[model samples]
Target chain A: MSLDKSVVNVSFLEVKVWRGKDDGELVSYQVPGRENQTVLDVVSEIQRSHEPSLAYRYACRVGVCGSCAMTVNGMPKWTCRTHVKKVMDDGVLTIEPLRNLPRIKDLVCDLSPFIDTWQQAGAPFCGTKTRHEAPANIDPESKARKAADAGLQCINCAVCYSACDVVSWNKDYIGPAGLNRAWTLVNDARHGERQSTFDKAFGSGGCGSCHSQGNCTRHCPIGLSPSESIAGLKKSALFGLPKV
Target chain B: MERSLFLTQRLTAMALGPLVLVHLGLILFAVKGGLTAEEILLRTQGSVGWALFYGAFVVMASIHGPIGLRNVLREWTDLTTGLINFVTAGFGFLLLFVGIRAVLAVTQTATQISG
Candidate 1:
């Protein structure tokens, strides 16, 4: 976590970083190698000593915040949790912004498109009950509740979004994360807009667009299976919605 | 609607799975038995079972093929949804017409056969 340049290093790691917006090239820098260093640590070191203008994002420096997600060596991952030794190839590291979103700068992408798709899929939960009423008793062990719980822990990191090929090919298709969010809401007993949510999920560029390639599931840092969530949505369409 | 199309595609696919296996098995049986074209025609001729089986196959295939084509065209091309639907519907009708004619030609009795 320390960027202090006074500490001498016995070995150096060649790190290639994307330097600009969409038209940028990978600029190389020799970073001091350290044991137990994360990819975020390397990027921070490069910014501290080599290029002051290099732009990227990170917070909490731990796995909790999903902001540090980027394409490392051709795979979408949470750079904060990814160690340098595990991802580097031939003593080299390549870092770039997450794909399927507009690049704002070097490694910072505009997350508006990702957020907008979530809204389009009716991901925002609509509450049917107010504070005055007692909370709805949902059995956690129920099939619908279990299905909902399976996808409820999404961090909205867009790692799955970046890994998805459907998003790259079909501009209108709401990607896996959004569909996953919709699925959780669909299974909820208290959501007032279940029908609308179903309509939105099955509409144009909805769950039907997913090819079930499992890229979203495979690349997810939180281990959530958006592919499974999407399949559940399709299954709901086949057999009517599960009775909550 | 997309939901209807999705459901239809899946249901037809389920139907097609067994139909295709039976069709392929029939092909192998005929080839192994060294049955000539005339011999195959004679067996199929005037048989309502063969007629109904092939009729169902053609109908399911006609419905199934274009729906899949619609999905592929929507994903891989710049065509409008309306245009894609139109094209796929036309393809389905074409398949039905040609498939029905072939089924009739094979299954019709000798007395019913015409030029």
Candidate 2:
């Protein structure tokens, strides 16, 4: 693909990028804009031409791998998927790291806390079948399986985690992603520790902590509804324990 | 446990939903002709229906209010969980005592006076 020289040099976008950790200041940069340029493209431009020390993380620039999420103009989003024109305010952009997590540097945040919360919610699936055992037949149209399918597409992007207000307000509260994962596992028939998942989900800082604000649902790039999953967990708790 | 508290709050809220509507509707209906304490007591005094309805209302509210407040305190304040639980439990008991007393004053006292 040949680059259009006229289009490349025609427009410059004013981008304000965060420069440090928690106490960071927004450093301004002039990034050359192109047609259909993404927020990741803007950051890459700043890194290549302007600031060599600009720290950010990205891979598979095509919206997979869930690595390019950042807070673009006060909203947590997949920067690779977010168009510059869509979020720019009057030809200016402000980008920062995802919220509710420890900031490592400029646009990178420590996802360890988010992962820890997932474990706390008992999100890891434990199957009863051994390697020699045949696959358990599950009806795809079953209600439980359907419910599990609703939340299975989560790529652990942490976008929903960053967007959750409950996580922001209560640090101990396991955010939407973890609860969503647990919901999927709770409905899985093959899961060996469904009861344990239920225990952790209904434990302190679990599904009960969710405010049902739907920020996770709204801000998810994949359109997954973690709020619904948490609601399912609450409803399941009311009925009885999960089937082991 | 958090699960039990969550269930209690939700169940009480469900009970309160219709109770609140009926209470508000009664208020609106009763005040149409301008109600007084004597007139209110005249209708409610010695009434089993009124006693049961208000008794259930008081019980549900006592359970619901503290759980909701516990959630608020947990989110908004930095208080320890144990302290919050203690305070909210005390609040629940206080609400129960006052609510039951009011129910008795409205129903039992009226029944005694009329009898």
Candidate 3:
């Protein structure tokens, strides 16, 4: 039997992508939009066909990499998972590099500041696991694991950074994603860096700075709740810990 | 001071949510019945009930607004928090004095308003 041919017609989609370095402008490019076309597909198509000068960054073309996040239609989204039908309006799409970060080139943002904030927020998993590390059994339903699971899905995408009004207002604020990351490490069983992490996470312009506008949670691609993590941090901050 | 003030602000806000609804309902009922400002004033001008209601309102509001303003000053201005707290506390007392004066003008005994 011959293949049951059902060829889906690909159409040229007009995507208005932000171009240039920090001092950039919005430039238009048309790309092939297939049946299940993602935002990254259009960008890559632009690079392949129309504009060789267009610069953007992405490694794995799936949601796993988390490298391809941008502001789509006035909202932050993981471009790899964001389909054309979800964001395209009247055949016009406005794509911008993520906000609250420096733009290195067209559609590609420098994540150094975002990653640095994670470090500053004390998000590293410092192990208390020694050279004589034994197989430590953790109950799946344990309080720490349950708490950590909610926040551990962060792909370090700066979509939360772009969505955070607090970060926009107070540049010193570590923001939702960073704070969420810190929350995960706080629940980590083997992390030796918990106390120091808690200290930095509770300081001025840290968790206290978040007004819980629900932006980070609202715009998150994976249904993660940064707002809840921030609330948890605030509750922890109000404890018997000595204040400076 | 910060913690206590924050707690008071939340408490007052909880109080005001209902008070505001009641105030709005009163206004709406009066407007619906075609009651003039003069007629409303005549009812409230000497009533102890009106005075007590307004007195409680003034106290709660005076407690809340200044604390909220202190945070606003700290966030928006170059003012030191100590300075902000001092200025806001002074303003709260000023609001209390004026509010109390108004309440006394309407709610106190005949001799109190006249004197």
Candidate 2: which stretches are off by over 4 Å?
A1-9, A241-244, B109-115
Q: Judge the docking of candidate 3 as incorrect, acceptable, medium or high.
A: incorrect
| Top candidate by DockQ | 2
Quick one: how many clashes does candidate 2 have?
0
TM-score order of candidates, best first?
1, 2, 3
Best by TM-score: 1
Steric clash pairs (candidate 3)? none
| Candidate 1 chain B: 10-residue stretch with minimal lDDT | B106-115
Supply candidate 3's per-residue lDDT for A73. 79
Q: After superposition, how far is residue A59 of candidate 2 from its true place, in Å?
A: 1.9
Better of 1 and 2 by lDDT: 1
Superior by lDDT: candidate 2 or candidate 3: 2
Off by over 4 Å in 3: A1-9, A126-129, A133-139, A188-199, A235-244, B1-63, B70-115
Per-model TM-score versus the true fold: 0.96, 0.95, 0.73
What fraction of the reference interface contacts is present in each model, in order?
Answer: 0.71, 0.88, 0.00
Model 1, global lDDT = 0.92
Shift of residue B1 alpha carbon in model 2, Å: 1.5
In order, what are the TM-scores of chain A for the candidates?
0.95, 0.95, 0.90
Which ten contiguous residues of candidate 2 chain B have the minimum total lDDT?
B106-115
